[model samples]
Target: MSVTVIRPADRAAWLDARRQDVTASVAAAVLNVHPYTSQYQLWAEKTGRLSPDGEATDAMMRGVYIEPVGVAMLRDQKPEWAVEYHADNAYYRDEKIRIGATPDAFAVDPGREGRGNVQIKSASESAFKDYWIDPDTKQVIPPTWIALQAITEARLTGCDWACVALVVITWRGTLRLYVIDIPLIERHWVAIKTGVAEFWRVVDAGEHPPIDWEKDGSTVLDVYRDSYTDVRDLSDDAALDVIIRRYKEAKELESSGKKLADTLKPQIIFALGNSAAGKTASYDIRASTQIRASYVASESQSRVLRIKPRRDHDVDASRF
Candidate 1:
């Protein structure tokens, strides 16, 4: 099959025709890239499954939630070449080299005289950071990998330039865009092509190839795993106890039930009350339920129960 060269006008029309479908396709492609796939696959393996499909699978739910959110965030950034939803480009070699990349959205800067093909990416904040920073050196990884992917798509369509636009949507719904230039992209094309060749070699040898990121000086899996482990380790029982108490208190408030403030562990109580009152009184009141009451007698001889409430719940009430 002859390679279909998509001109800027044609590309624009094609994207306008099928935007949503193309965006989903792009999101799926990104998910297949190094760190994303590795993390998901590891999660699946840990849960004793090859695929995240079951309704009960947390992995499946997480993937489902993230992809659409990422896509929406990308669309919201509204790149100049936002193509039709689901625009698909297929390139086939008559003998063998049949591979395709369906970019979520493709745009060209009319102001730049349609010089480059821009690929738009909507990513979770974590994924966005992982793509940039080198896992080993903690430096910014060259944008070559991104540029290479864009170039491959450009080559498939016989375009001269490739641009990658990444819109990172943070958990708080903030969007940030990163653009890749053509010179940087061209510099990395040869390495990406060589990496692809090595991948084919591994396939022919009946072995899965190690990811290019490992050789590219960064691995998403290592970074994600290391960060995850660090967080997990820091959340020890003592740390978690504080969180649990807070959660319980919040839940009780939501339900309008009597707050089980007393059931909160001593450590949490001490932390909450350490600022107010003397430590001795706070400790004495927390250690036992013996209410410390200060009495005031008016000139008329009426007694007032001056109860010192727990630090967090300072409800001052007088019983006559």
Candidate 2:
């Protein structure tokens, strides 16, 4: 595949290169499945709106420092693999897509008898424990997001495989290579290409990807912290109206459920006086008291709901 190359002289140049095109590292974000990065962040980065400063977290620095060690380890395992680092940004563009990839190492004439791209990663002990694999038993458990990243790079470089090398550092300062394997999943490559093209279309149209409140909570909090200074009441937006109506209905249901539970609780508790729990044909119920410290009162006693075995029961339409 023909690609445009941009050689970055330093970190600043590298950051600038990233702004010019979507890189393999951010492919998962474009797919809306990246653990740390949200779709909004990826859009901002690709659109040149996000600042490069403060982009490097402590873990990122650890990865940068440990990458060379990882490369050395990978070389030790496969002495015949010719590994070379690329300081230039590799970008491929066409009518529907503009993508970039900067591989950590490119292996040529490897012992595996195939050329491939190598990506090095460093993760915390907790995170590292998740990447363990067994070549003997053929058990491979890898992080999906990072695996997608390597696959995206392979797609861009026209390589059939990607070697993923990871350095896992423990809290006690121990380091280990938890996994080193070439993952060449065809389905991942196809999904990545399709998702990137979709993201590019969104960029071309000057629109943002839909925010996922559940997944984007941290990013939203960071961006809106002590902000929203020029806030104005929104007019009757139909989309927002749907959300608001659903929210209202949910709250009403919650209130009614709570009221019905309150009405049922005292009667059930009276029947099972001094007994901790009771079971019926339809349900198993338990009552427990909890004492919690509150600001208004030194200590407050509250009933704890402990219900289980929620079997199916017919609803009475006449009651409704």
Q: What is the C-alpha lDDT of each candidate?
A: 0.40, 0.62
Give the number of the best model, judged by TM-score: 2
Alpha-carbon error at 184 in model 1, in Å?
A: 6.6
Q: Please list all clashing residue pairs in model 2, or write none if there are none.
A: none
Q: Candidate 2 on 71-167: residue-level lDDT in tens?
A: 7887787677787765344444332367777777788754455578788887777765555544566565666787887887776777767868777
Worst 10 residues of 1 by lDDT: 223-232
State the displacement of the C-alpha of residue 66, model 2, in Å, after optimal TM-score superposition: 0.5
On the 0 to 100 scale, the lDDT of residue 15 in model 1 is: 40
Over all chains combined, what TM-score does candidate 1 have? Answer: 0.38
